[model samples]
Target: MDPILLTDKESSGAFWPVDGDSSLIFLGTGCSSAVPNARCLLQPSSPPCEVCMKSLSLPPEKNKNYRCNTSLLIDYCHGNRERSYILIDVGKTFREQVLRWFTYHQIPRVDSVILTHEHADAVLGLDDIRTVQPYSPTNDIEPTPVYLTQFAMESVAIKFPYLVNKNFKEGQEIRRVSQLDWRIIEGNSETPFASSGLQFIPLPVMHGEDYVCLGFLFGKRSRVAYISDVSRFPMSTEYVISKSGAGQLDLLILDTLYKNKPHNTHLCFPQTLDAVKRISPKRALLIGMTHEFDHDRDNKILAEWSEREGIWVQLAHDGLKISIDL
Candidate 1:
């Protein structure tokens, strides 16, 4: 049987599920270097960054432990019983992350993909999603909807050239993936695609020093907002998400790339909180942690910090799944 979800109303732009609702799930919660210097950089000799140090100072979730970045597995069940889903973001440890989540419970198949940016921690694991296709044998065939802004698509193309073949045409417009000049593949056959029940809303966010990044507003509003790579939310983005807050917030997954020192690109905890207050979603979760963060400590402190603010905050672990109301 499908999991229990809240349902009754109908509308986009709110976190409150429709009267006949659906769901979403978390995949990972680490920074680009999900493993810290000791792992990815192969610089086990280097010291942990200040953010990681502060992370180690907090209490651990004591339940699940994901190294860094995390995403959601969303299932948007409409009032009429139509079901469609989206893969919010894929992380570095994504392969490991999904395997763990599957071990505990069966989840709705990942239908499409929504990206925050092109950072390794978020996009590298994307290759693993190829495996998802084979698992959901009943769904119709379509190129996985990889939703992102024009700028983000450019970054991914440069980084993962093979994924989006220079000759492929169907994927050019998946989610405003730039670098698509007219006539790139003039003679190639058009491979058409569409997501089952997922709508892609591309949100442009400010990252660092003049570089704007893509933060996706999943399921339009009521379901979830996966904004992990942003340092600050642009007015346009705030406007888009503000629209989603009209309903009760199920989950507001956001960036927490820094603990104290503000970053040139992602948000520090304080900035993230400020945005949360304005958005005023029912729940909020922080993601994009660095290796310096010891899952054993920071979570406790972060939770305490969240409480003082009177906001419901939780540290994202490697394999945690949050079933949202509609």
Candidate 2:
């Protein structure tokens, strides 16, 4: 397949295509509540948030500050003629995101999906996979494979019982369930999984007191690590990331939810900065921002910080795409 540039109004000159390489697209960059929160809009505070105010004023087409739930799309060439797409975390806005960013008619189907955790923002869009099953690129009618931890799988079954139970009572209509083949991942394990001709290593991290969230490392030559949500990382996981290429990383997408204050479950600005220093990636892009952050203003802050710290860092906006050759 030849290199094709994917562009939209917000990302017109920002994206460049590269052949025989892998590309990562940030479909959404908001937290669980999402930017322009309904409650925030309904109940105005003393000093209204300029970011939210600006987002409300601009039209949808021109607004770059409006964010949806966080998700990533990994694309790579499978062979001479086929292109493969692997989605990471299908959140609440998954359907709208695909509709807005992808030429759905041109693409055949998604290769696979990997879930990060059991959070509603991460797994609620599982049902939407049914839409793409009929258009399987490989012409296989088999179920779509979804990989997640054992705990996450159980949570899915509980949340969407209808999808798992195939036996229906008499006279009950057979609902068209999402064809899914669930794969269980063991905890605290770094297993190498293959999809769409690319290899990924699941890196486990701490998401609070009880939850364990996953991050992923893709490719061997042009290594990219994506950890969209994380409060802390275990020492072993840190070793695995730092062990690669003397701790040099081609790209690192991390979580930075707040500007100054820290959250128990998400990384704030100070924590994210410390993480960038420790990991020492060649380029770092911050994701999982809330409405409290103004894209243009916060980005300027990041630029100055990057210069002072001598590390490349920036904020990830919706529809942001980065290509890396392996």
Candidate 3:
């Protein structure tokens, strides 16, 4: 089918494109420490975890059980040409994840990056973006655009001062300098933002006691909400979802770190199930999994639970892709 460009009007009557051939690829689906922990591999417990052992034994391409730090890639196309390659988080494993999934030949450039929070697992790879700067289709030699909340932006600046500083006097190679166009998102606001011709509404959700992480809702007609590291959904987020008028989403990617144990900052399986009930998405996929659960076993349980609950829910694995029709 031909890719259709979706156009919608803002409150001020300004029209923008919202429709396109969009596909979301799960670049990584593991927690901050990632799966198959080195510590776990070194010391063997009683009946060492078969999943982790197997993952270590096989190569990355052959191991479906291995995982990287959670992140996402939103690829959008208009007609025959690609429009946007929006990345969610660039964590410690960003380089390896990109090399594994995104080939140099297919996607030579990344249009933009949307940071969710300031955690090391979410923003540590900001500097590596320089690798794609030269391949930018615009050929302006300008910095690549990076969207983040005020808190996240500040945290990034503190972590990577060189990236934000335009007047660094150190003589360095052009490629070594961080080329980034920082865009700060306002606090406590659901203002819609545009990146690489795609529109996104920043849905603020709680991330433990001190952090407010931003999950994004993309596309107008068929929305896909990606909340990889959220602990709880804020009321304003629900209101925004309701106001969107779909009453349900095409896809909902949420954090499901543990099966029974709940963390102070991450959602457990039960909380993820509750979230699915609230959002009522057509399809739900759980991300940010730890090493405690094996992919095959956990997925079997999830499949059974999904059938019982009458909702389509599955565990998201690295490299999983889902196309959204808008």
> Candidate 3 on 41-85: residue-level lDDT in tens?
889788987767876786654555788999998887755675678
- lDDT, candidate 1, 1-326, per-residue tens: 33222232211111333443565555567766654444433433356354434444433333333354566666667667876666666777777766756444465356667665667766777667666654334323445656555656767778777567646476444322212111111110122123455544556677786866666554543556677778776665676566353444456788887667778888877787788878876667677766545544665665566567665665566555444544
Q: Give me the displacement of residue 4 in model 1, in angstroms.
A: 16
lDDT score for candidate 3 against the true structure? 0.75
**lDDT for 123 (candidate 1):** 75
Q: Is candidate 1 or candidate 3 better by lDDT?
A: 3
Model 2 C-alpha lDDT per residue in residues 1-326, reported as the tens digit of each score: 22223332211122223444566777788888887877778997778767778877865435557788899887776547467778889888877777755542244567788888989989898888777677544335677788888889899999888866666799987566677878886655457877557777888888886778999888777778888889998887777676343467777889989888889998888999998888888778888988878887776777778778877787787766666675
For all predicted structures, in order, the TM-scores are 0.68, 0.87, 0.86
* Ordered list by lDDT, greatest first: 2, 3, 1
lDDT of each: 0.58, 0.76, 0.75
Among residues 3 or more apart in sequence or in different chains, the pairs in candidate 2 whose N, CA or C atoms overlap within 3 Å are none
lDDT, candidate 2, at 111: 77
Model 2 alpha-carbon miss at residue 99, Å: 2.6
